[model samples]
Target: MTEESPGAPGGGRPEDVRHRLVEVFGERVSASVPLAGLTTFRTGGAADWLLETSDPADIVAAVRVTRALDLPLTVFGGGSNVLVGDGGVRGLVVRVRHGAISAHGTSTVRADGGVTLNGLVRWAIQRGMAGLERWAGTPGTVGGAIYGNAHFDGLMVGDMVAEVGLVDRTGSILRVSGSEMAFGYDESRVQHTGEFVLWANFDVAAGDPAKLRAAARESLGFRKRTQPLAQASAGCVFQNPRVTDDSLSGGVPRTAGALIDGAGLKGCRVGGAVVSTIHGNFIVSDGAATSADVRTLIEHCRSAVVDRFGVLLREELVYVGVFG
Candidate 1:
């Protein structure tokens, strides 16, 4: 039956939807799946249905079925930089797990969407490929990295991408060149258009393996030292404010952490969430933290920074599911 018509036996009951999906996807589909364990932040309620699959075919199938059923769908990768709500997600959440990579040459590699940014960096470094060395500790999958134009130390993942493989809204597979990606500050065309990245080819450059490894190590070390890597935080809470001629910060990119620190928000706490003393940009959860706690802390910091510096901070973290 088309989405316009109710499904068999139950007239489009949610349970009927789950049962129909089970017939198509088998054990890969789960109900009321707890979400906190799936994310880096380790907080949230659950997903009504979770499809865990390493097969691109399965991913596409899940997407197609959900669209046909008119069910809300969310694609979850190495969950980071997102806060799932306390009330849980209403429909289907497809969790990608197909992390495979292939080296085309010393200067090029291909990666599946589920491959972590850190994994791609290592793969390239191992093959003596350069250009991704500094993203060693960046969280999230290659798909997410591309979607958000993940960056560090003046370098961006988009710079290395040659092309992307995606499943569009209509479930057709297609390829788009890097130029067409329309990458910008923490944003990409895919993010705006709702295309799901399946894989990508990254064009790197030849480099010394030892040097690349050393560079990766140095970058990871710096992140570990400054950020609360051991803590339950969703990376940076806000995007760094751009510098302008009339900006409060001098004409250079201002760090979000510095702004929060300058605003005296470090160690500031609300519920089980606290801005990291080591790096004010991160709001580490104290295990018992709820989504509300994190959201409140984030808002408090945003407001405080605005009040103190007269510059409004924009959140880098995206909200998932629902919350109060």
Candidate 2:
């Protein structure tokens, strides 16, 4: 990571960065943009500069400019699983709106990074493609899911991924195979390394359209019943602990939500943030919840789980900006 320089233009200077961004994006840039309206939680403060781009060329240009200016860059997708600080972000926020999906063949589909997971699944199902139907109700964008290795039923998003179009730190585009990329539960190597994903080509399977639709509907129903979808949450708060051969259940660790609920932390509150009573692993924000409140609740859950089960949980959502 590059450290901000005090003397460099646009380095720690929000106004200069904003000016350059406006100059580059024309009317597409905004200052002090409220992040609350941009996220699922609706609880964050403003961003110093927000650049919404629908064109991949624009995104590439903005990235290049920000890099040359030594400004921090934070990428935004569906904003479904992010928790921005109440104090707001300082540099450039690139919001992707490149929603496009095209079927290449009976078993292949290419979608822009900004296309939502649900939308992709629906598109696949409509075309009688089978593989993605299982992910119908998963939130976030195609790029976000691919970056996070979003999974269902022992299958990860990377499994269906054929190739990923990525923009590296130097703004060069490259396509990488899913197998070459390291993928683990709830995380991908690209995500950990902060590589910007542009799009993905998926190799799906052919199936009956009705059957695929049914599968998608069933998955969506399951998600609705189990997850706190009606409330504001970033899906699961922690990744499930890695299973060991000597562990209980012959090696499989219990789900994080079950463990937290077993630890008697469900519905626990810290300020306006609370662990969802319906789902122990989900932290939801009330109308008055702040980023600090959510952080406190997360810490409380982590401590309680560690004390009870000797398992340390890792956060699933990425935190952006300064919270204090």
Residue pairs with backbone atoms closer than 3 Å in model 1 (clashes) = none
Off by over 4 Å in 2: 1-15, 245-253
Taking all chains together, each candidate's TM-score versus the true structure is 0.93, 0.92
Clashing pairs counted in every model: 0, 0
What digit string (tens of lDDT, one per residue) describes model 1 on residues 90-205?
77888886578998766668999988888888878887888888999898888778878887878878988999998887788889999999998888898888889899999888
lDDT of each: 0.83, 0.80
Compose the digit string of candidate 2's lDDT tens values, residues 66-181. Answer: 78788777888888778998877767788886578998877789998888888888888887888988998887888778778888768898888888888888888888887866
Candidate 2 TM-score to native: 0.92
